[model samples]
Target: MTNKVLNALANNSALLKWIVFLLAAFGFVWSMQLFIAGNAYYSVKNSIEVWQLSPDKASTQKVNSALDKIDNALNYFPNNALFYQIQGQLFEWKAITEANTKNTDSPTTDLTNKVFNLQEAAKSYEKSLKLRPNWSGSWIGLASVKRQQGELDDEFYSYLESANRAGPQDAILHKFIVDFGLQVFSARSFHYVKIKERLKHHLNLGIENPLSRDFVLKTIQKHNANEAVCRWLRDASYPVKKRIPNCITYN
Candidate 1:
């Protein structure tokens, strides 16, 4: 009798069909999520490519369009940490745009808009970190936002440290830390350990990408820290070193 019951259950076509239907539904949901995410990422990628080609063309309309798409993606998949990080970046840039075009007649209104956007950026970064605590970019994003707000507390430095720990050799991470590193070089609360090492790493990448050589040297000079920058690049390859003759000549 037990064998008969087993055979009957094994031959249950209705149960098998329900199982197949459930599997297909799960696959469809998963695929649809990826589709939405891909479109959102494409929107971000396209915006960045355009900005790189024509940064002077940055405008409110372009940013708002990107923000709208990302918001729609978040509505469908609220758990994507990367989406939150991207959202944070968009808000941060929007705030920068507001800052660059402050209205003299309505200075208070401009400041308020800038602060509100920055606060929103910070919240998005915090949400991303909560979802995926170890993402180096999100850490950098939060750190950048805090710096913008001029509220660089212990956590701000900690976030930089976290980003450093997460991706020590990442060229992109090196770029961010070097920029922020120069800003707070003399701050009493600044974390000094490994700071120079990261800057050197960035300069090394600048060496490989010679197009960035001038930017690096210019940034270094602007900070009045070319002396230090020259010292860092003293050991880099010879070809790229020649591009920054001012630094490498005496370096």
Candidate 2:
């Protein structure tokens, strides 16, 4: 009876050990699955936040850093359209910085560099558009670069027109169009146009027309009157009607 009791006790101990081992195995598997799921959620959440934050901020450094993080995430999920779009936007931000820093004394060289950067930006935006054709912002970005480059005026206009058609309700798109029109006027008058024509075309009477008025107003607001261009701009602003042409009136 003592030997039998001892044998039964040994059997119970072995069964308990097997149960404990199985439980431990299950726990390990469950823990691993939870960890993996948590990591995936964190990664996706971070990516979405970065996408949302990039376009809202105007700082170049911040935009670039966000894009770098997004690119790193893409190694794991290579097909994220948002990542591509944000990357394109970052490139565009850089291009805008380059374009706006032009030097009048070295207009040719400065413009050349600006054009190169803008073209690169256009390529990146085109890539984003390829991934997500419905993104109106990408089309606007592409058009802005084309405008900066000055090599494809018609194509640039077409892109802007398409962007408008795609989403006329987007106030940001309209603002971009307005700002771009102003920039083009500033650059053209500052570098390309003769003083007389610049005044007549950009600042003189009937200039308040929709197309030219915004540009004239923006130029006067941003530049000083000491320069010849500024002198004309100042003179142009005197008569309100003279500064803006009737045809260019915004409804």
Candidate 3:
């Protein structure tokens, strides 16, 4: 009985030791990957910020360098949603840069690059959404890709609606949707009510913030949306009307 008990104890100790070894090995690998991912994340982040601030000045060579780092990081850490999101932005910027450089000399090649990059951006954004379904920014990125693609307006609006639903109180989102709504306000079809109601929601939300209110008012004036602005703010308070000089003046 003593020998049997000792044998069972030995077997259990051996299993525990193997389990600890495997866990330690996994943890070491994971930490190394995290280190790599963190370095790549900051590099990619700076690249994205530069592109957003001044896409015209962002060189293709630098963007390509960022892509290489991102691809390498993704290989090491495939499931990083933020990496995918930034990758999408990089591709989006590359697409526009390529398109802007288009000329008769290489129009076809530029067009091909634009289409391919935009498609890759869309794919990256979609993957990010799959990983993080509730991320409003990715939804907007997807919508932007659809809009720039300039086909299937309904699909664009659908993604936009998803963004709105995902972040009803997101100030940036409100402004973005409002800006786009006014852009095609006169020409929108099928989704007219949907867009208009969302515009109204954002406008109402905009009234709460001085900066947002001023921006919306100025944007409305810029778009020559006097009638719509006045009508939308019909039940507005005196403070609201005071900010919207154009609305009061036009009416």
> TM-score winner among the candidates?
1
> Which window of ten consecutive residues has the lowest lDDT sum in model 1?
186-195
Residue-level lDDT tens digits of model 1 in 1-251: 69999889878977899999999999999899889877987888568545533555667677888899899888888988889988998888888767778789998999899989998998998899899988887888888888788876888778888987876655446556666666656453345454656667777775465444445555566577766666777887777566554665443
The superposed Cα distance between candidate 2 and the true structure at residue 55, in angstroms, equals 13
lDDT of 2 by residue, 5-109 (tens): 999999999999999999999899768755654464355445434433333334455445655665665554455555555556556665554445556788788
TM-score of 2: 0.45
The clash count of every prediction, one per candidate, is: 0, 9, 0
Instruction: Please identify model 1 stretches exceeding 4 Å from their true place.
Output: 1-11, 49-54, 181-197, 205-231, 239-251
Candidate 3, residues 1-251: lDDT per residue as tens digits? 69999999999999999999999999999899889878988988866655543456776677788888889899997887878888887888888776666666877888888889999998998899899898777888888788778764778878877887887776556656666677778566555566788887787777666535555665677788778777887887767665665556534
lDDT (Cα, 0-100) at 231 in candidate 2: 44
**TM-score result, candidate 3:** 0.66
Residue 248, candidate 1: C-alpha displacement in angstroms: 6.9
User: Candidate 1's C-alpha lDDT?
Assistant: 0.75
> What are the lDDT scores of the predictions, listed in order?
0.75, 0.55, 0.77
Candidate 3 displacement at residue 143 in angstroms: 1.2
